[model samples]
Target: MSSTTRAARPVPACPIRPGEPCTLCQVDVTGPQDCGLVWLVMGDDELRAGVHRSRLAAPGRR
Candidate 1:
């Protein structure tokens, strides 16, 4: 066991069944603490496939 291995883990494709490839990418973000958050992103066909994390509720900027 190593820090790199512990920090990162492969996320298995969801609903693995029949004949279908999953549209997913996985990366492990970890360090000294748990930062209670997980993200699901939708890609954009415009501008190099930009990524944005959807807000849980009302969006605010400061």
Candidate 2:
């Protein structure tokens, strides 16, 4: 089997916690901040609910 590295998925705009940083980019970001396409729609409850229900339900503990 070829050991091929998979392409990284595009990151959502959701910011890291306060004083928290993005592991991929190492950028210091936080909530209520805009990153990109996904984050842009984060304000919409319906969209958020439909798309991020699972993620919202299962958050990793720091």
Candidate 3:
């Protein structure tokens, strides 16, 4: 058998969804860095807080 090496692709993390990687779900953006939904959610103080709270309340989450 022959062995070949391939470069590892870096997985970008989701900014709003803690401990989760970006899934590239947005059609207009490449990743979480350029995601409009992430920007909008993060831009609002209340929304950001709500996301944080939800993350904390998730089952099996630390």
Alpha-carbon TM-score of each model against the true structure: 0.15, 0.28, 0.70
lDDT of 2 by residue, 10-35 (tens): 54433423233444443444323435
- lDDT (10s digit) by residue, model 1, range 1-62: 65554555643322221122233423453421222222222222332133222222214511
User: Which candidate ranks first by lDDT, i.e. highest?
Assistant: 3
Each candidate: RMSD to true structure? 13.8, 11.3, 2.5
Residue pairs whose backbone atoms clash in candidate 3: none
lDDT of each: 0.28, 0.48, 0.87
Rank by TM-score, descending? Answer: 3, 2, 1
Question: Each model's number of backbone clashes?
Answer: 0, 0, 0
In model 2, the Cα lDDT at residue 14 comes to 35
Model 2 misplaced regions, further than 4 Å: 1-32, 56-62
lDDT of 3 at 2: 100
Question: Candidate 2: which pairs clash?
Answer: none
lDDT, model 2, position 42 = 56
State the RMSD for candidate 1: 13.8
Alpha-carbon runs more than 4 Å astray in model 1: 1-7, 16-62
